[model samples]
Target chain A: MIGSRQHGGGVIAFTFIIALLLTVIPLPEGLRFLRPDWVGLVLIYWCMALPHRVGVASGWFMGLMVDLLTGTLLGQHALSLTVIAYITLKFHQRLRLVPVWQQSLTVLVLLVLHQLLALWISRIIGRPGVPWYFWMPSVLGMIIWPLVYVTLRGLRRGFRVS
Target chain B: MLVSLSVVLMVMDHRFKSLESVRNTLSLLVYPIQLIVEIPGTVTDWLDESLATRRKLQEEVDSLRTQQFMQQAQMQKFAALQAENIRLRELLDSSFEIGEKVLIAELMSVNLDPYKHQVVINKGELHNVYAGQPLVDADGVMGQIVHAGPYSSTAMLITDTSHAIPVQVNRNGLRTIALGSGTINRLELPYIPNSADIQPGDLLITSGLGGRFPQGYPVATVSAVQHDPGNAFASVVATPLAHLNRSREVLLIWPGHTTDINSVVSAPVEASAEKADTEAAPENGEAADNHSTAADTATATP
Candidate 1:
């Protein structure tokens, strides 16, 4: 059991890396704005599932990697992710008892907050505001939340990660 | 605490640019992930190229041959015109136009945000690319380099809202600033007086007034001009000549690689500083404006 616990960290790390790659894959021009918030979704899931082991620092690290990969302002995603991770960690116990569909609704709200924070930072830095389509990804993130939660939960149970 | 740190980093990146080297180094570490992410697209592009039919290849070759013949004929005329222009400039005791040196760079990826018209190119600091260096395609001016990583660089297209280029009417030499309107096909010539000599179908060329771009490159064509007596400035719009969204390769101009290009040293610093300043939300435009003007005069004299 202790050995499986030790190996659980590796599984989390591997999944996070895969999420990062998914965030960067080139999308067709017509669907560019619809690209999912893969990294944010993955980090949120890990923070909820393994609150003690994965929290604000890990979220910050993943966000920084996304910022670098996308060539955006260095700490733009990091700051937002840290805040969301902290909020999720604070409520993990209550969140765990919630139903899957309700959990996705909560994720929708969290993703909206994340997008707002990023938008605020970019505006402060003088980037012109984008159109309504900029918010489309957050909606898609909400829809994909259940799939991400189910998959990560399956992996945790299969590995006896706790 | 993390938020404060982020603000500090943002300020440093926007103001001093002290974080550029750090960004470049971290980009090197992150290169493998980017490469992995790009593989599927690259493989598909390669497959498309390899699977092309022989008939298509033959047709393409024939068209290219015709283009080459036409270009050669034009080049013969250009060579004579250039020699005559040099002689006339010498007679007038004016500085000769030095031949520009350029290197080809391939597009790697694009920033997905439609608001920010930026693209990553395969060449970077290793290829002597610097921030604010002018970029062009075969048709016309495209944009300028804004960040040079170790192995890759980012360019801000002229259509980005924050970008502004100094241009003159190719026919009458009336100078004005062409500001990007965040639309791919259009630019705004703000601050043009109502009585300005611009008209539809006029050719706008880089004036070399600001020193970031070389003089006399075709930039755009005036598409509409509206004079409003109610407002102080006229509404002028122009369409960029470059294939901003479609071009696969771009030319990075090494200004004054041949002659004493006076603006080559200070042009990029002032230009990028202006860009960085715009990010800080600062309105201190006088110093950079002065610097560019000084560089412009220096270049004009030789």
Candidate 2:
């Protein structure tokens, strides 16, 4: 069990690294709006799968990394990510029991909440007037939740990440 | 607790300099992740270069050679004009401006936030890159460095909404401020008077009033001028000359610090040994010559 836990930790970190890479990778200007929130999706999955291990603190750390990586205001992403993780952890038991599609709907809410928090922060910093397409990533994140869920689940089971 | 901590951090980061050291330290940890993310793009670029046809490569070389020759001819005229300007400036008893020492840095990442126009370049504090340092491309001014990490730096492009540069109309030397309009292609001159001499197609260059960007770099061209008689100011818009979306490499300039020429020439070679391309040497040599000539004029000024 100890060995499996250690292995699980590595897998989780690996996935987070991949998600970070996806978050910052350059895409065509037209498709940028369609790019899913990869880090938030991965964070949600891990929080749901292992709430005790990947909770608010881990989420905050991941947020800080994202802030540093994207060169945004320090703690901007951290605050949003921490809230998302907290919400996921609070309802992880029920979240794990729901069907994948329903979970995706919930994921949509969380992702939107994540974006809303970031938007609120930016507005407070005096950067307002984002376009309507700002909400596209949340919807795209929802659409990709199932794919992320299945793949992470397969990796979890294969690696005995429990 | 995490929320409050984050809020405190944001306040410190945005409102104070207390978090700068913390940010720099954290950015060092974040550097490897950025480098890893850049690998795929770098690999594809390398592949593209290696896979290009012989005929295409020859054609590119031929074109670049012709372009170089034309630039050299222009440089000859520029040298003559600069000499005349120096003599005239000496007669007027004013300090003459020297050529800025420049280091080339490749863009590591593109637009991080859709709302914020920022790019990461491979050069950083290790190469003496600093915040507020001007960035330029082959065509014109691009942006200025905002955060300089150990191995990389983040630059906020001139098109970022919060950015503004002091500019002058190249035609009449009419000084005004150019403000970024949150779009890559557009910049706004919000304070131009309705009866101002500015018109569409007039070129705007940095006025050097703001010490952040050096003078005389092409910034933008007036694309539209709307005279709203009801309003106090005309709504003038311009398209930035720099290829903000396309350029892969940018030059970081040490403005008015010609004394650092030797360090500028040798620093990048020592810092990023892999990037010690042969192209940099000749460019630095040319810049050094310009600096020496300017220095001579500075001393010769009674």
Candidate 3:
């Protein structure tokens, strides 16, 4: 709504669409253990891009979609994602200023928090609790963070085509 | 405004049935994008299979051939014996047994949450897939279909805490319940007596207790039998007979006109009247009995 491009919000929403697509794509059973949190990845990107508008609420909205899409208890992921967004926004200025390595470390902690929140909610709510495999997404998401942040950050910095 | 929209939609789905049609429509809208993301994985799999060495392929072919030969050797006699058994049963006024109609579906991707035991399959409602369908592999029953999508559906594996399968001791036909432990290929058979007639290597099969699954399909093999002197109930642990890890293809079998007791009771008559829309098949004489049971439960539930 500010001096940003006329199409920024539209493009940002489209990216969320792409993230949803990637989230449901079937990975092989073996590789399924390592599937990254596609929604979390994309949400981080957009939250960083347009923090003021696409903050915790956007995360919660996207999180609700994830729950419905995955057929989980609705609001399970929404609450955790919203919490993640809130913390990210609370320190958005600091996160924005850090170097790539420091930023990656910060994202790892964020992913952990997101997952821990989900784990805690599930535990309290009487859902099945598997061992570390539930946290595999955070590990995979962290591994994917650098590549994603680098590529997307490059697009934002270099490719003004959008 | 967008937050309110999402909230309203979420609430519409959570509290009422108004948003299901919308959810289904929105999910279908993403099908093209879903296909695009899924294509790469499929292509990679095809390439991987095509790239398998001829020697390895030949080994597989040889093993399969030898196995088929062994089966054929038994099948010739078994066919004659089966016909005789069927004839003898007909003479006794017993009807022929009903079998499951199976559709082989590929394991798409597992849910991102390790805590939940759910997976998506390539086949969906588009392929006659539906809720209440039993998922299995060559080995045994894995789980049931809890949600059905258009192009892709989700399966909750038996190893989930939310899942429960009725099982029986194959040796003595003693009925028991198998509940999932949320880990891959594990289940807990809780509340059995210390003196229960179970052994470490005993095989468990679908007891058809709940009628959700067909009777007699293998469920699991008891891995541990903990009989404590102090505790009255022995703690039994078993691994699911289905190779939840190794199975590439699984069978999605809904009740196909099964007069199974499970469906008749679990589904309300009001719902069973809607069973044509409910997605389970009725087989056997149970569909006829569905009437009295449905009437009974209608009065039973408060």
Question: RMSD per prediction, one decimal?
Answer: 5.7, 8.9, 7.6
lDDT of 2: 0.82
Docking quality class, candidate 3: acceptable
Ranking by TM-score: 2, 1, 3
TM-score of chain A of 3: 0.87
The global Cα lDDT (0 to 1) of model 1 is: 0.78
Residues A1-37, model 3: lDDT tens digits:
3445544566567768778876766555666666777
Better of 1 and 2 by TM-score: 2
Q: In lDDT terms, which candidate is top?
A: 2
Q: All candidates' TM-scores?
A: 0.88, 0.89, 0.75
lDDT (10s digit) by residue, model 2, range A99-140: 999999999999999999999899998886778889999998
Off by over 4 Å in 2: A1-7, B259-302
* Candidate 1 lDDT, B1-302, residue by residue in tens: 77677667767876777898888887786677767876776888999889999999999999999999999999787766766666665555545454587899988754444457788788989999988788999899999987788888878888887788877799987777788898889999886889889999999998665557777799999999999899999999999999998898899997666433323332211112223213332222222221143444233222
List, in the given order, the native-contact fraction of each candidate. 0.50, 0.71, 0.21
How much lDDT does each candidate structure score?
0.78, 0.82, 0.68
Angstrom error of the Cα, residue B190, model 1: value is 0.7
Off by over 4 Å in 1: A1-6, A159-162, B259-302
Structure candidate 3, residue pairs in collision: B255-B281, B256-B281, B257-B281, B257-B282, B257-B283, B258-B281, B258-B282, B258-B283, B259-B283, B259-B287
